[model samples]
Target: MVFWLVAVGCLFVGEASSSDNKITAKSIRVVMDNNYPPYAFLDAKGNLQGILIDQWRLWEQKTGIKAAISGIDWGEA
Candidate 1:
């Protein structure tokens, strides 16, 4: 489930030139809910964790795009 969502999200990053199919940028900013468990949360070391985090890793590996992932409380998400 999370894997599909992350994969779809990667397709819509829109940091590329639609007309020419050229990349315009290589970085993305993402905010995940730290309050959610197993889906999104912060680890003991203050790093993002859970299924979404792992999926993002795969997304970066396949697309060569850099994502600056961050975690915030539910209210912010």
Candidate 2:
């Protein structure tokens, strides 16, 4: 999934952003489950953690673009 996101960013960076009828920015917005451990979870320090965060680091390294993540309830997903 991380690879796919990076790929999509690389392949169609401007095209999709331009077509979307929403706010536009150079960064990408991503939402994740707040309590899923080893994937994405809130830490004791109230920071994002787990394997997905590591993956996101790699994604940012490869894509050279920024990603903003939000943790929210699955129902809100």
Candidate 3:
């Protein structure tokens, strides 16, 4: 899937560019549109939610990397 591809690509790029070919960063930043609904959005409680949010959480657990996921207005994005 596209998500997996992008995640892997990021890892690859990180490794490829590092002096020791390793992922040196402890975290990654991800931004998404807050109004996209099911894919990504702010819930009634004003928290990030939806499929992308879930996937990113899982990715964080699996990769052991903190993902600072945030959302902004689509137009601003």
Candidate lDDT values, in order: 0.83, 0.84, 0.91
Clashes of 3: 0
lDDT per residue for candidate 2 within 1-77, as digits (tens), equals: 99999988877978877787764456898898888888998899999898998898788788777888888877886
Highest-TM-score candidate: 3
User: lDDT, candidate 2, residue 19?
Assistant: 84
lDDT at position 22, candidate 3: 67
Each prediction's total of clashing residue pairs, residues at least 3 apart in sequence or on different chains, is 0, 0, 0
- The candidate, 1 or 3, that scores higher on lDDT is 3
lDDT of 3 by residue, 21-76 (tens): 56878999999998888999887899999999999999999999999998999888
Model 1 accuracy (lDDT, Cα): 0.83
Which stretches of candidate 3 lie above 4 Å from their native place? 1-20
Give per-residue CA lDDT, model 1, range 1-77, as digits (tens).
99999988777775443555767569898888886889888778988889998999899898899988888887877
Among residues 3 or more apart in sequence or in different chains, the pairs in candidate 1 whose N, CA or C atoms overlap within 3 Å are none
Residue 23, model 3, lDDT: 80
Candidate number of the best lDDT: 3
